[model samples]
Structures are given as structure tokens and as C-alpha cells.
Target: MARQKDAFYFDGFRRSADYACQAAKLLSEVMHDFNPDQLRERMDGMHALEKAADGVRHAMMDELVTAFITPFDREDIDELGRVLDDVTDSIEGVLNRMYYDNVTDM
Candidate 1:
């Protein structure tokens, strides 16, 4: 049998998940090596990652809006994307709090 291509946009969802994992990892590293002095620089890096992830989600959504047939339910796909974005946002929130509080010790 010939291999079938992924009809659903599962790869996009997977990519978003991967981004969330990376953001979480970065958050852990920042906390482990907490350096108030470098907080701004570290945040810049995190923002870049977040922005890239957002780009992926947006592109997916744009495609989804015009897709006639999707692999999964549209609601589920949208929710998945939103949740992934939330994870990244939450991690950034924690880092933001730490930075604002001048948390020097992990």
C-alpha cells in the first residue's frame, strides 16, 4: 500500500507542542541560573521563541479558516493551538514576575 500523507494539520499542532516544551525548558534554565542582571536579555530570548511559536499558530489558523476538510474537528484544532500558546504565555508570566521582583536567588 502506498503511504498516505497527513490529511490533518497534526504536524502544526506537534510543532506548537514542541515550542511549548522548549519554552518550559528555557524557563527552568533561567530559574536555575537566576541572574537578575541578565533578566532583560533572557526575556528577550524567551520573547523571540514565543513570537516564533505564535507565527506558527497564526499560519495554521489562517489555513484552517479556508480549509474545506480538516483531519479533526475545527474546535479541537483551535483549542489545541490556544492551549499551546497559553503554556508559553504562562511560562513567560512566571519569568516576568521573577524579573519584576528582582528575584536573584533561585
Candidate 2:
């Protein structure tokens, strides 16, 4: 049971981090393609990836709460989870701003 719980926590963290990295890569590609123009379409994909990351984060939290012992400090785990989520949220916000301002061009 303990090993399974540890695996779940680690897996969730890995998945979340992977999503963030992938989203950043996608956003970078969008920026490259759009150049100075706002990245509207690129944002759609970014948002999707962000949501995926959030899902993993929520799963981790849920598991954490149910487990009697965590491999790391609960606060640390929560903070790391939030930071990963923040990366996606921040990207989404940038996309939102570009879309609302009608500055998006490619």
C-alpha cells in the first residue's frame, strides 16, 4: 500500500511537470510562427495542455489527502503542485489578453 501510494504521487508529479514543459514548447512554437503577432490559435492548444496538467495536479492532491503518509512534506507537495498549475494559468492568461485585445494575427 505504501509503495503504491508513493508511486502514485511520483507519477502525478512527473505527469504534471511533463505537461507544463510540453505547453511551454507549444507556446514557443506558436510564438515562432506568429512572430510579433498575438498567438490566438496557439492559445487554444496551450489551454488544453494546461487543463491536462491541472487534472494531474488535482489527482495528486486527492491521493495525498487520502494517504496516511506522504513521501515528502505535504506543504512542499502542495506548493510544487500549485507552481506547476500556475505555469499553465499564466500561459492561458497571456493568451486571453491577446485574444480579448484583438491583437492576435496568425
Candidate 3:
């Protein structure tokens, strides 16, 4: 069946938040384990989550560029997207530091 476009207003933002949650959850998993032996493997998995989040952010931006009427101010939406991206990036950064510094213990 045909769908309605305006039926969903904050879908992009919701998806971005979902991505942030996923990244945070994975970060928690890696921190809890603190397994240096499998650090590379865990980082690889984190990279996948980061990339998926990036994809969602990029798609949202592209949609924003062509949207006629957003639920809120466009700048606000953009800023929110950036902030959420930073959150996921920061979570990934923690993993990166742990892997780089050989920190295996809590």
C-alpha cells in the first residue's frame, strides 16, 4: 500500500537516538569484559556500529536538505544530530583508547 510521508515527523531523530543507545550498549559490553586479547575483534564490532550510525545520520541530513516543513527548526534538528553523533563517537573513542593503551583491567 502507498504510505504517507508526513505521517512521521521525528523519525530521523528517533533513529539517531536509537543508534546512540546501541553504541552505548556495546561500549558498556566492551568495558565490562576488559579483554585485551580480543580487543581488536571488539573494536571491529564497534566500528560496524559507528558506521551504521553514520549512515543513518547521513541519510537524515540528505532528507533535511530537501524537506519543506520540519517538525522543528532545521538548525535544531541538525544540532541534535551532531550532538548524538558526537556521543556515539565518544563512546567509540573510549574503546579506541583502551585498545591503544593496552588497558585490559578495570
Per-residue C-alpha lDDT of model 1 across residues 1-106, encoded as one tens digit per residue: 2223233367777888888899899998987887788889989888888988898899888878997777768898899888998898888888888888878777
TM-score for each prediction?
A: 0.88, 0.83, 0.86
- What are the per-residue Cα lDDT tens digits for candidate 3 across 3-86? 354334367667777878988898888778767888899889888888887887888788778988776788987898888888
Backbone clash total for model 1 is 0
Stretches of candidate 2 off by over 4 Å are 35-40, 104-106
lDDT of 2 by residue, 1-106 (tens): 3576688877877888788788777766766676444355577778888888888998988887887888889999889888888887887776677667776466
Error of 3 at 18 (Å): 1.5
Ranking by TM-score: 1, 3, 2
Off by over 4 Å in 3: 1-9
Candidates in descending lDDT order: 1, 3, 2
TM value for model 3: 0.86
Clashing pairs in 3: none
Error of 3 at 2 (Å): 17
Error of 3 at 28 (Å): 1.3
Error of 1 at 46 (Å): 0.4
Q: Go through the candidates in order and give each one's C-alpha lDDT.
A: 0.82, 0.78, 0.80
